[model samples]
Target: MDWTTVEKNWAAYTPRVLTRWPGLDEDEVLATDGDLDRFAEYLAIATSQSVQGARDEARGWAEGEEPADAKMDPTRDNERIFDSAKNIPVGEDVYSADADFGDDRIPEPPMDRKAG
Candidate 1:
């Protein structure tokens, strides 16, 4: 009843136990120390498909780590921000007030939307 044998057996059995219950944990295996062999055998019986499923989940998580869930906290890039700020046109004058003109010489285009 060596712990290593049990541990290795547990590791091998883990995927099997996980097949039926994807969320099963190592604690479940350790809980039955006396019946490690029987549990390992059970794991042997039940784990093939479930172990593969666990593997798939692990691989999916590994592959998907950087996609959306692994998003880090928002960061501030002061250099980039300053770079963009420097590019702002310095000479351009922006005015909100309208100009006052007395003469109306420009012909205005029809405002109504005509049928095409």
Candidate 2:
């Protein structure tokens, strides 16, 4: 596949991917060519297919075509790594420490029902 086709596929498929995984915002998704390339890389790995094959499969998905046979069982390690990946935020500060807004805070731990 040519660079133009790769780029075009990236642009078209990105929004569909984001919609499926709504935890990520489009702005926080494929913002650059490198990011788009990485997206394709992961997709290919997950499907156990070549980059071009994965791109073609995903293009069908983006076009509202019947689902192609791009899916395969990812390895356990790969699944864990994919789950662990943090969403890349755009134009926003990502504080290492999480903060909860003030006012209503739970001070005591709830009793475990399983203990009964």
Candidate 3:
């Protein structure tokens, strides 16, 4: 993985780093400020691994990392206007006077009263 890329996008990767090494605190991780060597040092202390081992693990994590935007749920942005639209009645009830055939506009009220 490119350490430079990770450094350039540090804020996006911080959460993943914390997940990979929950023993480390957010303040401590943020303090590294995208320095690979400093991050490796923190990882080593938190995981009880050697600096080299921590570096290797960090590299592996970086390799597996995807952009945060790509991880968003597809359904999260969906706008459902009507939840009960899916439960339409069939057979005899299908031809009701109140059956809505996709026309959602509200009709204007009649101007029965005369202006003064």
Candidate 4:
């Protein structure tokens, strides 16, 4: 399948499931926000290319030839778009903190060493 078709599916099906069924009910799959569709679109495009590339590479390998894309960078990030995830600050409030123990706590001793 072409990437355009996958992108189309990403655009179409995204809104239908926005209000419900992001995945499961409990745990981290809570919000059915529309933002996830962007990820889906990204993944779909990546997956199609990846699958096709893998297939072509494998075929080339089987024929005793190097894969055409084997030496090329799959993601040519000229503007560092994909790298933003590393710089982004996520999970700001999903986690809660408890009270921290202070100077009054006793330190546990290290395990006693036995003769080798």
Candidate that would win on lDDT: 3
Q: Ranking under lDDT, best-scoring first? A: 3, 2, 1, 4
Give one digit per residue, the lDDT tens place, for model 3 in 1-116. Answer: 57776776677788888887877899999889889899999989988999999998888888885675433424423423244445765543545656365444655456995535
Q: Candidate 4 — what's its lDDT?
A: 0.36
- Tens digits of per-residue lDDT for model 4, 12-108: 3333233333342332222323234434443335345454453443233234322233313344354245564465455533233312323435545
Which candidate, 2 or 4, would have the higher TM-score against the true structure? Answer: 2
Over 4 Å off, model 2: 1-15, 20-39, 65-116
Candidates in order, TM-scores: namely 0.20, 0.28, 0.57, 0.16
Number of clashes found in candidate 2? 0
TM-score (C-alpha, index-matched) for candidate 4: 0.16
Cα error of candidate 1 at position 55, Å: 25
Q: CA lDDT of each candidate?
A: 0.43, 0.50, 0.74, 0.36
Q: List the residue pairs that clash in candidate 3.
A: none
Each prediction's total of clashing residue pairs, residues at least 3 apart in sequence or on different chains, is 2, 0, 0, 0
Overall local distance difference test of candidate 3: 0.74
Q: What is the lDDT of residue 29 in candidate 4?
A: 22
The reply for model 3, stretches above 4 Å from the true place, is: 69-116
Give model 3's TM-score versus the native structure: 0.57
Report the C-alpha lDDT of model 2 over 15-94, residue by residue, as the tens digit: 55766645545654576442445655666765578988866655554545312222222323574466555653453344
lDDT of 2 at 98: 33
